[model samples]
Target: MENNKQPQLINPAELFNPEPYGFSHSISVKSPFQMCFISGQSGGEGENHVLTDDFKMQVQNALKNLKIVLQSHSMTFENIVKITLLIVDHNQEKLEIWVAEAKKVWKGTFLPTSTLIPVSQLALPGMLFEIDAIAVK
Candidate 1:
């Protein structure tokens, strides 16, 4: 039987609220649908497979790549339940940029739960940002 109960959102008083950043502190989901975990996407294009140097550009391309993956699997942004964002040399400015870009793609649907990680480097060189996602149907 499919569980009809929805996941409860929790934001502890001790922790700061992160709703403005296009995500929540924590979320729970109890569903009977299949869950899809998409691998981290990069910012590369064409035959040369060149990664973008600009942070904003990379952010956009990475999201575009993610969209391709979602569509390929017969899903869309609304199906996403969680996300993990990794940014190189992260800072408040970069975070602001990220949130702006994220808001563009996830303009609606209450924004999915997310986690942001500041990392010094990624698996591939010259990758400014990467995003992985989890979606449930």
Candidate 2:
């Protein structure tokens, strides 16, 4: 795909640079590209959909699941323009883990815009983290 069709990550001078946190302030996408909206993915696995209790594992698994969906469309993390993260019992430690996992997925300068929402619970028990993404190509 052409570079112009990719999402443009922007962190304005007036706004705080969110790169240290593993995201951008905003993203701009051009036309002549297809858009993909993925549903929230959690740490659950297998036919029974069992979720792991470990917070870091959950975060990793969630990102892995997101990647599975992206690959189904022949896209990668670089194609993602935005993501929404849900963390159960959010805290500094959990945030750090999430950022670390996100950095592993998005290694380049173009990080996706993200919104993190902390909640008491998720769709499934033992689910500690979830992530949904929007991608363009």
Candidate 3:
């Protein structure tokens, strides 16, 4: 089976650089034979399902959880075309942490086109970050 890869990145000179925010202006995909949309994933897990307040921890765990979901769906990071991040109390510091965690997750691999959405709050009170993904194959 051919593993669909990250979409083509589009960054027009007219638009400001989106790299700092860990996203692109747009991404175009050609062959999306199959598509999967995973809902926003949070950092909390296990029986207690206790969410962490640490932004970095939340970013890490959210990506990890997304990985597991993709695996179960027979997809890898390459198959992901886009990722949406919802950050509570978003700021430059949080964006940096998110980019750092993303580098770790997609190390030596093509980074999926991503979007970071700043919001006042999330589903849970303590949740710091939530990530949702769209994959193709």
- Candidate 3: count of backbone clashes, pairs at least 3 residues apart or interchain: 0
Q: If both were scored by TM-score, which would come out higher, candidate 1 or candidate 3?
A: 1
Ranking 1 against 2 by lDDT, winner: 2
Among these predicted structures, which one has the highest lDDT? 2
The top-ranked prediction according to TM-score is: 2
Tens digits of per-residue lDDT for model 1, 1-137: 85546564543333334365455433444456655666676676543447878999889887877786676556788889899999999999999999898888887867899999999998668998989888777
With a 3 Å backbone cut-off (N, CA, C), the pairs that clash in candidate 1 are: none
Rank ordering of all candidates by TM-score, starting from the highest:
2, 1, 3
Give the Cα-based TM-score of candidate 2 against the true structure: 0.76
Candidate 2 residue lDDT tens string, 83-107: 9999889999999998888888899
TM-score-better candidate, 1 vs 2? 2
Error of 2 at 38 (Å): 0.3
Candidate 3 regions with alpha-carbon error over 4 angstroms: 1-32
* Residue pairs that clash (backbone atoms under 3 angstroms), model 3: none
- Cα lDDT tens digits, model 3, 64-118, are 7777667655677788888999998899998899888888778765778889899
Model 2: lDDT of residue 21: 55
lDDT of 2: 0.76
